[model samples]
Target chain A: MEQSFDDDEGVRWMLAWKAGDEAAFDRLVERYSPQVYALLTRFLGPRDNREDLVQEVFLRLLRNRDRYEPSARFSTFLYRIVFNLAVNHTQRVIQRAEGSLHGRHGDEDGEQLAELADDRASAPFESLEQDDVVRAVRSAIASLPENQRMALILAKYEELPYAEIAGVLGSSEKAVKSLIHRARETLRERLAPFLKEELA
Target chain B: MNLECAAFRRELQHSLENHAERSGAPLRDLLWHRHLHGCLDCRELLSAEEALEALLSSLPNPKLPPGLAQRVLARLSRPAGAQAELDALLELDRPESARPGLAGRVLAHLAEERALARRNPQPVRDLDVLLELARPVEIPVGLAERVKNRTRASTGTRGVLLRWRWMAAAALLALLLGVYAYYPRNPQPSPMVAMQDQPDPALLENLLLLEEWELLQGGDLEVLLSTLPAEDEYLLDLGAEGATEQGGQPKKG
Candidate 1:
């Protein structure tokens, strides 16, 4: 599906799924799976476990189908669960690096976000072998303190507004902007070689 | 880079990041503030940013691993098959992954505070009563007369209600915090943007730093809102201070 169902439609589907309309649950999966898969890949790198994590997100959705509240946007609830799952999986390796020392106050709320390519054996990102610009950008993104990276993905790729991004990350909009700003600055620094070369 | 260049770079970045600065602000505004006319490096950086942004956004989403949705649906369909496993998998939620509504609790706290405050509101003692407490006469009669007259002039015109300006401000501040707490949760853009117009939050924020909220009374919210600094100024202020106050760190309630 080129453009999946909108958030309202997703809510309707959730309501239907809650009403025991099994097809509604399928529609919900069809609408959100690519997005969930893409977001998980962005956050955790291209690991096989992401497939399982994506499944778990849906399973949680099935379990919490009754927990869906119409007052909030369907996407907000879904993304909160998604990001939370991503954060849980990330803290093990990401927090081990330099970000642990330069910890932001928001770290405790979200997953301890900061990942490493230079660290221990399980360098999941090593699987992503794109070309130069792709490689450099991904590296810079991966190197970002996890919170900044998550904020950047939601803002830059997901195109979620700052406010929604903040909610999903369990942060304030101002902090979301700060996260993106810092993320951008770091990316510029890390990808300086490409940017400077492109400028020349 | 030298400190001056660093400062220039910072200013330039702010100008670029800020939509108002990029679209409407003239170079003369920055040039007047700093000697930016001679710098070639930042000039190139400023221009090259568009290309950089294109490059940044150009990175595509990875192709989804095949059958990702089919697999999710497969599990959803076969509830009986994965029942025990799904039940066990649900237990993986560690404590940090939980996103309880901190705002709901803080807002409840604020409500309890407001209720308690209302039940035992600030005593509305008269300013004259307060002033009378300090009236032991040890001064020369002339000096005492001068002091008393000035004191009367200051207090007589403002009346006693202004003494409760702190309470009014606190009430308004609580109202403002409630409105602010609504922003993150409000998914719609127009409503949240409209909420910004109700009262000048920045102006009200300064109220918290006061011992007595003398600038505003209960009736003055509309007056203050009407006289607020321009929207561009607010955005510029947020952009400038965001890095330090709002953006710098996570301030947990």
Candidate 2:
């Protein structure tokens, strides 16, 4: 990935927005909306709830404009906010889906099993094989412990350096490396069948 | 290949994570190279890891919905008052004096305190009265008149009177110094001094009353009475006299 470097411009706009310039805020929103949208989409999966969440991320930026610390890169601060909100939205969606079923089914374990089965059965891919591969990968990513999942997203999707991801996640670079290492190992195991199919 | 499988796995994981580290390309450890050549399972793991990375990297970027920036800006087009409040909230790092409506906020806060004080009037009103009393006194009209009259009457003798006043002050100061010089530094109490130092019967009776009320325990009463200094005893005596002067009225009901 080509690592983009418009930080100086982005930071200039943020500082200007902090001083109550509306155009600066507009510029910032325009510049970062795509990244924010992409993060929310991946974090929340293919759900329609992401659009609102992306808007909320920007709204939060405006609402908290004055509190921005220029010493820190704006992207790190923005990702922290986006990650928090994304985690919250993801948890809410999971809870709502589970809550509705828990009332109907009355057996929590069975419902959880059913949910897992449904996740595999309902993957949106072109063919059965592709669906299995894609589903396995997505489910593996989703099932990761929140920190590992976020570490992978920030490193792989955002193309952030380990040090920068560490800053975003409030962890050491070594810790982030271990997180991504463990996460990738898990993904490799889950997708091994598909990899072998490709080899065959 | 003499590489332990576990060590090879660890190195492979490390290399994969650090492959594109800002410094340069990943390290190619000899053990990992030998293990991959010798072990089919390890080779399969590497291939799978590479495929997973490719799949992840190739995932489509989520397109921004049409008009998101416009929608966000539209939401931000709040009324001017709300915009100012938002600006104030965002600029909390700015100095309080630099924030808009600060004077208005301070005046509002003071007005709230004034209203609250009015509602709970007794303590605040008492404090206000105490402050008024403590303020410096202006010259009294009668005293002013008296001083002028006396000055006119004693004009010829004024210098002599002033000299006499200084002499009186000097004599009082000398007496005070003589008494201070004669005073014992750490006087041991004589029988007469002990008798004078003893608390009044009325005070002893009050301590006994407090004990009956269970307000003062026996040990506490002894500690309290034993630890009181002569100055505290004098003040207690004066306080008792003042209370008696008021016919021993209850200070609180």
- Considering every candidate listed, which one attains the maximal TM-score? 2
| Cα-based lDDT for every prediction | 0.61, 0.64
Deviation (Å) of B66 in candidate 2:
2.9
lDDT of 2 by residue, B99-143 (tens): 664433333333334433543367844464234223247977799
* Model 1: pairs clashing at backbone N, Cα or C within 3 Å: A94-A114, A113-A146, A114-A146
- Runs of candidate 1 with Cα error greater than 4 angstroms are A1-7, A93-131, B1-42, B79-253
Given candidate 1, what's the lDDT at residue B84?
44
Docking level for model 2? incorrect
Q: How does each model score on TM-score?
A: 0.46, 0.52
lDDT (Cα, tens digit) per residue for candidate 2, span A1-200: 54444567877788776665668877888888888888876665665545656666765665455556665577887888788776655554465466666665545335544544433333333333566555556666676777788889887877787887888788899999989989887766665666566656
Per-model DockQ: 0.20, 0.19
What lDDT score is found at residue A61 in candidate 2? 65
lDDT of 1 by residue, A55-145 (tens): 7677567546555666456777788888777765555445434445576445432332323442122322342333457655666677777
